[model samples]
Target: MAYAIIETGGKQLKVEPGRFYDVELLHEEEDAAISIDQVLLVSDGSTVTVGRPLVEGAVVEATVMQHRRDKKIIVYKMQPKKKTRKKQGHRQELTRLMINSISVGGKALATA
Candidate 1:
């Protein structure tokens, strides 16, 4: 029941150990380790800690699984009487990560 809210790739996510998540693309080799310190909130079942902007000494560890692109989305536009039309498709780059652990003040709070 331990979890933390972290900021990355201009987004906030609720994460827990042993879970896989896809976020904005990361320029790292597969299997590379990374630690995120932009923790906004954390809960360890018994207590909760909230940060003003970011929690001090709070870190989340993860490993890069792979890099991929998300499903394509289409955009279409048309004009009446002008016969003008446009169509476009776009995909977002993403990175897959496996959360390994969550810690606070150098003490492990959750582990995969």
Candidate 2:
């Protein structure tokens, strides 16, 4: 199988064509095309390329599928004998992306 390691939203992901991924929030409308260039590694079943920091001319193309919030998480705090308590809930915003293709040196290497 062909895949690539891409960095985005302060995290790295192992991505393949035709797959969907939920990542940190992105400031873009749904269906917008995005290209990620911070590719750390790429493998085509037989060959593998590893970047020092990032691979030159490597890009991963994706489309924004949706924007949504993750599951809610609750935080509670209490102070013993102080009658102090706090409660909070949070839901992180996230973006859904559909990976389209992976390319290097302007040549397409893999596609969905």
Candidate 3:
């Protein structure tokens, strides 16, 4: 079994093929193809490899499942006994990705 930790959008994620995750939105459309190449660490059951920043010749391939917005969040402010109130809402832009494969030196890793 193999797995890798990769960075994107200033965050690191443990990823493997066949799993899905929400990441920062890309300019591509739904069902589009994408690749990520910032692998930081990789482990293959018996051995573990860590990169200084990123492993050379390592990459992760993924597919864009869709573009969507996260659930809206409400922000509120109130002043006691002052009849002052404020409300706000926010939604985050997100891209849904289905991990296709993770490879080091162009070789796909076995499922973890």
Candidate 4:
């Protein structure tokens, strides 16, 4: 199997074609196409390519499946002696991305 490491939303992730991953929210509409060029490493089964900072001409293409929010979590705080209490709930915005292809030098090496 071929895989590549990409950086997005201030984090690095291992990505492959035909797989879906939930990443930090992207400002694109559902079914929109996006290309990520911050490839750090690519393993094409037989050879590996590591970039100095980012691989030149390397890109990972994906489609935005949906925009959703993560499961909510509760936060609670209490002041035992003062009889003060606080409670909060939070949810993180996320986007579901389906990897479509990985390419180098404008030639796709893997596809969904």
Q: Give candidate 2's root-mean-square deviation (CA, Å).
A: 0.8
lDDT by residue (1-112, candidate 4, tens digit) is: 8899999888899999999999999999999999999999988889999999999999999999999999999999999999899999999999999999999999998999
User: Which pairs of residues clash in candidate 1, taking residues 3 or more apart in a chain or in different chains?
Assistant: none
Candidate 4's TM-score: 0.93
lDDT of 2 by residue, 37-100 (tens): 9999998889999999898899999999999999999999999999999999999999999999
Instruction: Using TM-score, rank the candidates from best to worst.
Output: 1, 2, 4, 3
User: Tens-digit lDDT track for model 3 on 13-87?
Assistant: 998788899987778888888888898998876888899989998888889998899999999999999999999
- Top model number, lDDT: 1
Model 3 quality (TM-score): 0.88
**Where in model 4 is the C-alpha error above 4 Å?**
none
Candidate 1 whole-model C-alpha lDDT, 0 to 1: 0.97
List runs of model 3 lying over 4 Å from the truth.
none
How far residue 52's Cα lies from its native spot in candidate 3, in Å, is 1.1
lDDT of 1 by residue, 3-111 (tens): 9999999999999999999999989999999999999999998999999988899999999999999999999999999999999999999999999999999999999
**TM-score against truth, every candidate:** 0.98, 0.96, 0.88, 0.93
On TM-score, the candidate that comes out on top is 1
